[model samples]
Target: MSVVLAGGGSAGHVTPLLALADCLRRRDPATRITVLGTAEGLEARLVPARGYELVQLPKVPMPRRPGPDLLRIGGRLREAVRAAGAALDAAEADVVVGFGGYVCPPAYLAARRRGTPIVIHEANPLPGLANRLGARLTPYVATTFPHTPLPHAVQTGVPLRHEISDLARADDAERLARRLLAREHFGLDLDRTTVLVTGGSLGAQRLNDTFGEAAPDLRAAGAQVLHVSGTGKQVEVRQSAGGAGDDVPPYVVVPYVDAMEQAYAAADLVVCRAGANTVCELATVGLPAAYVPLPVGNGEQRLNAEPVVAAGGGLLVDDADCTAGWVREVLVPLLQDAAALRAMGEAAARFVVPDADERLADLVEAAVEGRRVPS
Candidate 1:
């Protein structure tokens, strides 16, 4: 049997697809998993590395702003759907699952025309524009959040790295993570609080710029900061730190963190955005974070962060209020109060669903096996 895994344009979307692929392979090794994505997406490298056949399409995002550019995006959407239909014909896929991103438009619409069972995993608390538009094309809707707005929602939580999953299951998530990879790889101080600052793989400009000004204070607190600066911002971020320490200052900055499992494990606190999949992973790992939802359309990141914050597992800082002083103000006391930090960590642990991968695999299995079974 063949399964089509569709989602990308960013690392956040690809991570879950990788997770589900791992689960599906174990359940049914004979399964041939094909990844359908755009040529310009991050999937170009990610999919092939995972040993899956990649079906590339042509598409671009519906830009955040309004104007005539919307017309171009609409044209691409139509062309992408047609491209996906062609791929489906070539692959003879039995089922197609969309993990959400710009890739959803083609995967969902094409699969619908082929009468292939369609499944969508909405990985944001507030659905993205692509996901909200794609939901109507599929009856099988799965969610990373427990109470997302999608219809017929099955709470699947988030699929994590294979190593992270194994570590989390061994009852020594922190220790296993430490041994499996060294924080020193990123030049982080093992004795000090290691706060990871990242805005997904492409990097968040606002996050990088904001964290830049706070580096001095963070270093003075005896904290080590590992900032993942996407693209050309590495020099600026490093310069922003102002030589906060000696021995490379243990203030590391990288363009992209290829080994993300170590990053999460080494982090005592996280300063980042809250995308649906990442939030689930953070909760699973029981790490407290100060989240600044990207101040973009619909405040989607805030929506994603709400449940965890409400549960006392994390803090939410609006973008307008997120500044260097604000970062130190929230984190300084939290880091100083070890007991409160531990409590918040424990709160985060409460949100994890241990059997999420298996459960999601079962749902996919049922769809591929057939819908109308004898009672």
Candidate 2:
């Protein structure tokens, strides 16, 4: 079987598509998988490196307001749709799976015109423009969150990395052993509970500033910090926490944690942004979180964190107010309470769907066969 996946722009879109692609290839090594993305999107680099074919399309981002850009978008979209059709023909895709992004809409349309099966996966609680449009074109729709409003949308949890999915389903004894081993290997203070803070690959300056400010309080509460303060922000963040004179600093700051699985294993609690993938990974790894949702556009970040918070697995913090005082007052106390942390971790582990990759692969197979998928 041949499959075409459409998505790219950020890791949020690309990662899930890759996860699904990996699942398909594993299930049947003979399966041909092609990724449709714009030359400008992240998929150009990621898809090829993953050993999948990448077909580039002209990016046609829809304008938000009335402007000359809006007028030019129609012509660009037509050309993109043509390009997508040509790619699909070249690959002879039996089914097109879309993980919503700018590249998806045109590809979805092209697949529909060719009478190829279409499957749409929306990772955000609030559906993006591309997936929203794609959902109308196909009844085979899946979402990471249950509340996403779409026609025939089924709750098939976000497909995740194999490492995270395995960790999620591991026995408690095994999980604990790995966590302890990871902490020791990282030279983390075993005496203090670990608090992992990250702002993803590029890092978030807001997290750096506030978390740094609250380092003293966190340490006083017997919690040690593992802060991935983005790339260039580390120097200033470390200096702000307290320079070289600071005695045995409680916070271990790094630009990035190359092995995120290890970081997740070492964490008792996490403090970070509430991206779709991040939320799923945190829940899968069974770690309680204090989510500071990005205070920007459509408020999707807050919505993404709501389910986990509701399940008693995490807490949501407003971006502007995620300051030292808030961390000291709320997060510090939670970290110090071992019982509460354990309960939260249990709740998180219970809430995740450990076989999301397999489950979504089933959906793709169903779509290809023109069978109705259970909602």
Candidate 3:
């Protein structure tokens, strides 16, 4: 059967859909999967790389302020619907599964008109505007959080990569993976601890700046560092703090790290944004993290980090208060105490709900195949 896996514009939305698609393909190798995204969405880069066909649509991220932007969004949505219709017709997709983003609203609507089943997956604890709009078009809605308020929304934890699901136990796997990946990928000293820091695919200026400032101190403490620098900041970070270690580059900074499995495997601790996907992935990998939520829009990112923080697996750092000094002070002690880090990892692991991808894949398949999902 054909599945139009619709999601994009952000890594959070696209990541889960990819996980679900991967699970569905494993369940049935004959499953024809196509991704719906715009030229600008991360899917344009990620989907095709994964060997899935991408149906490029014209989509604009919903504007925070409504005015000409809203009008432009409306026009784009109409165009998006038309583009999705063409994609659906060309691919002969039987069902379209939307992993909640701006692209979802139009794609879900097109699927509805075609009498195709539409399944919406909302990854955030709180619903976004696209999911809210898409919810009106379909009765099959799934959520990551248990208490989401959307009607017809069932609690199905966010789907993560198979690599994460297959992670071994705390000491056996994390340590083993960490040692191998750190030495191989970053060429850092395996004798000392390693900290992996990322700001997502788009990267974060604040994170890079803070970490870059602490490069000398981080290296002096015998901690190998792998940092992800935002697009424009890569040159700056490399030119400034990358030359600390004569033999191994003390700190390795890159625009992005595609191999998340390796990164998670290599890290003793993670320091980054508290995006919904990051939260789920951290739990899946069972890593200790110092979370700094992006200070855009509302405090949704901080809210998402709540479950992890409360569980004692992660520390919440408000972006406004996250400074190089604060990060150094908090992480230096945690890194030194291996027992505390292990305890935090165990606590984070408690939040990971296994078989999330399989559950979501099963639900989507059943809905499209006209089989009732398990009650």
Candidate 4:
């Protein structure tokens, strides 16, 4: 089977596309997979590294207001569609799968014009413009969260890397062993309750500042913090924590966590932004979190964490209130309660759909065969 997967702009869009590609390869090593992206998107780097053919198109963002760019939008979109059409034809694509980003709409339109099957996977509870458009073209729509107001949307969960999925779905003994191993590998205290603080690749300034201020309190409560302050942002956090100590400090400040699975394993609780992928991964691994939604855009980040938080798996703190005071009053007490933590973790695990990648792959195969399910 020949498949063309589309998405890009951020890791949220690209990661799932790679996961789907991995699933397609595992299902049939001979299946040809091509990824559609733009030169500006992260997929330009990530897709090629994953060993998939990447077709680059011009980035065409939807303008929110009237401007000179509005006139140029039509020309740019047409160019992107034409490029995508050529890529699809060249790949002999049986199905075009989109994860919903800047590149998806043109890819969807191109595939639709060619009468090729289109499958869309929406990672957020709030559907983006591209996936919403794709959903109108086909009933084969999959979503990470339930009730994501889109046409024929099925709750298939988010496609995660095999390593993460397997670890998340592991049995009691295996999961425990892996977690222990991860802590040892990271040189983290096995006895201490570990809290992971991350704000994403470039990092969130608010998270870094607030967490740095709260680090001492976190340590006083017998909890160790692993704060990933993004690239080049760790120095400020270290300075805030009284510079780098000779001994293993209660709070470890790192620029980035390249091996995120290890960080996840070493963490008993998480404090981070509520990106779609982050919420899904946390739920999958049964980790409780204090999610601070990014205070920007269409408020989609808050929407992403709503279900998990509602299900008693996590807490949603508004961006404005995610300060040191809030952490001292709420987070510290929560960490102190071991029973509550376990219960929340159980709730998170139960809320997750373990086999989303395989299930979505089945949907892709069906689409390739011209068999369209009602959702």
Candidate 5:
């Protein structure tokens, strides 16, 4: 069967799209996959890198306010829908799968116009405008979070990469071995408790500054820090008056980590933003986390972390409250308490659906075959 997948603009959208495409190919080697995205979006590079045909679409963002830009959107959207429909025809798509992003609205419209089956997977708890609109056009809608308000939304969880998903099944000995290797790879001390601080791929300035300031205190509390400071963003470690001693734990910083599974393995606890993918991956891997939701963007990040925190899997703090003092008071003691960390990690693992990739692929197959998807 041939399929066209639409999503892009950011890693959040592109990552899951690629994951689903990979799952579909693995399930049926004969399947042909085409991706629809803007030429400027991450998908331009990532989709091709994954060896899928990417059909570039003009990005026609739906303007929020009434303005001249809003007036132009209708014409732009018409052109985009025409291009999208042409691409769909060229690919002979039996089904079109959409993850929420700027490219989705046109794709969904084109698929509907052609009477091709459409499946949508929304990765955020708070549905975006594109997916929200797409959900009305199709009965097959899957969601990463359980409570996303979409019609016929199935709680299939997020489609994660195999490398991240496989961590859920690691035996104790294997886990330890992987952890040791990961620590060695990162140049972190194996004996010390490790706290990983990340702000996703682009990095967060607030995270870098706050965590960088607290690094000395964290080391003094007998914990090593592995900080992924984002690409081109440098984190300056602030030492105390006496400066760091040989006995103090190591503080390592890197611009980016291409191999994130290794970083996840090496970390005893993680502190990062509450993006849907990050939350799901951490839960799938049974890693305890302190999630600081991004202060912007319609409050979806906080909503994403709520279920995990409510389920005893993780801790949540607002962006403004995630100060160095808060870290010293909360994170330091939590790191020192190994038993608490174990309990939280177990809770996290229990909350995840590790086989979400397969589940989502099943939905796509059901759509293609015109079979009823079992709820």
Candidate 6:
């Protein structure tokens, strides 16, 4: 079957699109997959890197307020829809799967015009404008969060990369072996209670500064830290007492980590932003986290972390409240409590639907075949 997937702007959208594409390909080697995305978005590189044909579309962002830009949106949308329809025709798409982003609106409209089957996967708890519009067009809607207000939405969870999904299913011994190997790879002590601090690819300055300031305190609490400060973002960490001594827990800081699966494997706990992808990934891998939601957008990040935190799988902290003092008082003690960490990790693993890629793929196939789409 020929399928065209749409999403962009960030990893949260593109990552799931790629995961679903990979799952579809694995299920049927002959399936043709085309990705519709913006030339300027992360999909420009990621989609092509994943060996899928990427059709670049003009980004048509909906103006939130009445302005001169809003006046021109109609014309811009028309142009984008025209381009999106042409791409759909070129691919001979039997179905259009949309993950919410600026690119999805045009793709959904174009697919509807062509009488193509539509399937949408929303990764955020709060639906974006693009996905909300897409939901009106199709009944086959899949959601990462159960509470997302989309009609006919199936709670399929977020589609994760195979490496992470595989990690989720690993046995205890195998997981421990992987943990040891990952720790060795990251130059971390195998026995240390390791905490990983990441703020996604671009890194959050607040996280870098606050976590960096708290590093010495974390080490004093007998925890090692692996801090990914994002590309070109420096985190100044002061070591405890003797700089590289065995008594001082290691506080390794790097700008970026290409192998995030390895980092995930090496971590005992994670301190990061609460993007839907991050939340789902942590839960799927049975890792406990201290989620600091980004204090912007439609407050979707906080919503994303809430269910996991409520399930006793994680902790939620507001961005403004995630100060160094908070980290010292809360995270340091949490790290020392090994039993609590293990229980939280177990809860996390039980809370997520780990096979979302396969489930969404099933929905797509059902949509194409005119069969009943599973909830």
Top of the candidates by lDDT = 6
Off by over 4 Å in 5: 64-71, 240-246
lDDT score at residue 204, model 6, on the 0-100 scale: 91
Residue pairs clashing in model 5 are: none
lDDT of 5 at 365: 87
**lDDT ranking, best first:** 6, 5, 4, 2, 3, 1
The lDDT values for all models are 0.77, 0.85, 0.81, 0.86, 0.90, 0.91
Model 1 backbone overlap count: 0
lDDT of 4 at 21: 94
Q: Candidate 4 — which pairs collide?
A: none
Q: Between which residue pairs do clashes occur in model 1?
A: none
For candidate 4, write residues 211-270 as lDDT tens digits. Answer: 888876776677888888888885344233544454434677788775687888888999
TM-score, structure 3 vs. true: 0.91
Candidate 2 local lDDT, 1-375, one digit each (tens): 999999998778888898899998999999999999878776888889889999988888964334687577788889999999999999999999999778887899999899999999989988877887888888899989888898898889999877777777788898888888888877786656899998876788889999877777776676788888887885333333444353443577888775588889889999999999999999988899999988888899999888889999989999998988998899888887999998998787778866777888999999998899965
Encode model 6's per-residue lDDT on 66-87: one tens digit a residue.
4687577898899999999999
Q: How badly does each model clash, as a count of residue pairs?
A: 0, 0, 0, 0, 0, 0
lDDT of 3: 0.81
Off by over 4 Å in 4: 64-71, 238-248
Off by more than 4 A, model 6: 64-71, 241-246
Total residue pair clashes for candidate 2: 0
Q: Against the correct fold, how does model 5 do in TM-score?
A: 0.95
In model 1, which range of ten residues has the least summed lDDT? 235-244
